[model samples]
Target: MSARFTRPGAGTPVPVRFPRIVREALDNGLRIWTIPYGAIPVATTTLVIARGTGDDPADRHGLASLTGDLLDEGAGDLDAIGVAEAFARLGTHLDIDVGPDAMTMSSAGLARQIERTLELLASVVRQPRLEAADFARIRELRVNRLRQLSRSAGTVADRAYVSAVFGDHAYGHGALGTTRALEATTVDDVRGFWAGHIGPAVATLIVVGDVVAVDVAAAARRVFDAWDATIGSSRIDRPVVAPDRRIHLVDRPGAAQSELRIGHLAPGRSTEDYHALVVLNAVLGGQFTSRINRRLREEQGITYGAHTSFDFRRAAGSFACETSVQSDATAGAVRDVIAELGRMREAAIAPEELAAASASLTRGYVRNFETAGQVARAATQLAVHGLPDDTFDRFVPAIEAIGADQVLDVARRHIRPDEATVVVVGDATVTAEALTAIDRPLQASAPEF
Candidate 1:
């Protein structure tokens, strides 16, 4: 007997429901969230501290990032090698990430080793070695990396773009501080930053795996109970984005291509129009089949690729379009990008286009909960952004509910093509004549790295 197989047809996607999360707060003020998944005998833990580069002192721009790097280099009684061995013994690895709004220390291991993992994490957070030699070596490495970035056109353009858009705001500088600032950072400065920013009051511990939530919570209590309750200043004042549109050119002599960054301020992650913005962005430039890429790469043959994104932060974020093209074609590429942004706002999208964008977004949403670790990370982001616990459950419905009118409405309200700050990194001498069409006097400056 032979069996027949048929290709699956596209069906309406059912809403996704995440595993129930057990939430609790400890005596020391650490928020503990646990999700039990028995599909596999593994567990992942993430400790998110609500302190990041945005809190760096004005004079010490990379303080938050540097502090995160040194946490596991030597902590409690373990040296850097000792710390590595500890995780190796548990058959796992420790990962650290520093961003604009927070820093996270994460690890995944066998479910049976969850207790030992939490102990190691608590030591790294509460009892960092903060040794002088480790600090010196790490700072040198970071300074060297920053110097290398100065030679890359993409990096220079990105740094110049953010600085131009934000001005003196805290978000202006890159997480990697300026060369001068890194040079000035001292061991004492790093120690002070750790003492001030790290504490239970501003931290949350998230655990997800094939383990009991009650047991996990008890284990966390035993390890982190005595941790300090001191809270740091984590509030970010809303940045004042000046409505000034201008073309700023960074002179990168002898460059063959121009790196362009065009952007303006937009709503944050918690906006009510989040779903509409996502759909709009997909049609505009967020996807490979987006209008910007099709127009520039396929139709015009001007660049290899072009894309746009919203850097959604805890506060107001920026909408940016990035691309690289021949130095001679810089002005034309910029005009095309600006025109596309305007078209998204002014024109009515076709029903087929809207359907494609919606499907693209919702189809990918299922990947968020394919593993315990991903679920935990998603939950952590919800907490970070002050979103409701059921945000994931409603995600598909929200995307499905978006109409073309709503997407266009959000585009019109959020995107401001006329107020964009354009940063161009290219051979200024070769591109001078072509850039004159931008209608703004070019402000020339050396790369500030």
Candidate 2:
């Protein structure tokens, strides 16, 4: 890890100046946020489509995912091989990913090669040809992956955990959708998806690194200006909240141990309690030496590792703790975790521990922007959500401002043990028996297995 703060006696501090904000919209409804960082000749661009898996129609569960993957196969006039050769020749680093909430395509290359990079990016987005054969190939790839994933205790537990917590909601499904969904996907389905989801209307084009605002904006306009401007803006419908608590077990036969996952709903990235909850969770279960990890792993010898984290999505997210341990120790380990969580909520934290967690959090906050890629992504997030450009600058003060009492208060309010959904994946007979031994009800149903 790099040093999170400036060293003592470092040269006199120079006031950091971020790029000035410049925003514009093309005639076709594309929005752009440009930040010029001319210290180096490398330019990075992030092209984000607001539509993601959550926007998929009920009948087209994996359409968005399929569309994202197919974009690089062939576009406009470039074949898949040709596109790869082009980017390689230019020494550009390009990546494309589709998530539950959004789809992003980004690249970084020498500023001199930006025009060609943009051309490749635009072709991928505007003219993707989702061939029937390619669709079948990708589907086969995904199905094979699901088969291999079924053999892992940890994978089974995570799938069951989310399903048990979110039920039939969109958030319940993984970004790739289910194996059955992938099987039913078709080439035309993905093409139609690209038409609706990947366009200027849903676009948030971000250019950061060593380039002027005017020149970067011109590059964006050259590539995306003629692209269809009429695709409608993307919108996500509201989701129904899941129930407070439940226990779900996914049974994988012939397994010696159980993989456990406990989940609860929590605030999203935009919540005001976000910073306080980060501190609270770090003190409770977020760290290697956190209360839950120390008590369950070090003291009880329940598992090799245990950790908790908030999903941090655009809407309300899930908080989850995951670990795999001996089937016989499964229930006891879970109970110990719950006990520590309750203790953290009920008692005031020791001042030294609280300070340490706060300091650690402060350090992590500073490290978040050390790379050009990180800065580009953060800038895109700010533009997409209309957040303050100074969002991260206030992070340290916000964490430091949180009082110990406030951490306890948030813990008490957010960490509800009874409302949690617990999932254990292992042999059905042994797993259910173990859970039953702990006085929790056990139902022998089909797990995400």
TM-scores of the models, in the order given:
0.96, 0.91
lDDT of each: 0.88, 0.75
| C-alpha positional error of residue 99 in candidate 1 after TM-score superposition, expressed in Å | 0.6
Per-residue lDDT tens digits for candidate 2, residues 1-449, read 46767443322222233446678788777877777765778878888877787777775566787788888887777778877888888897568888767788898888788778888888888788778887888878877887787777777777777667766666666666767777777787787777766778777888777767787678778988889934545555334665545457677777787887886877666878888889988887788978778887898887888888888767657888888888778778878877776787678899888987786677556556655677788887775555687776677778888999998888888888767777777777666665776555665445432
Deviation (Å) of 315 in candidate 2: 1.8
TM-score of 1: 0.96
What lDDT does model 1 reach? Answer: 0.88
Q: Write the per-residue lDDT of candidate 1 for residues 38-71, one digit (tens) a residue.
A: 5799999999988888888888898889999999
| Model 1 regions lying over 4 Å from their true place | 1-10
Q: How many residue pairs clash in each candidate?
A: 0, 2
Candidate 1, residue 393: how far the Cα is off, in Å: 1.4
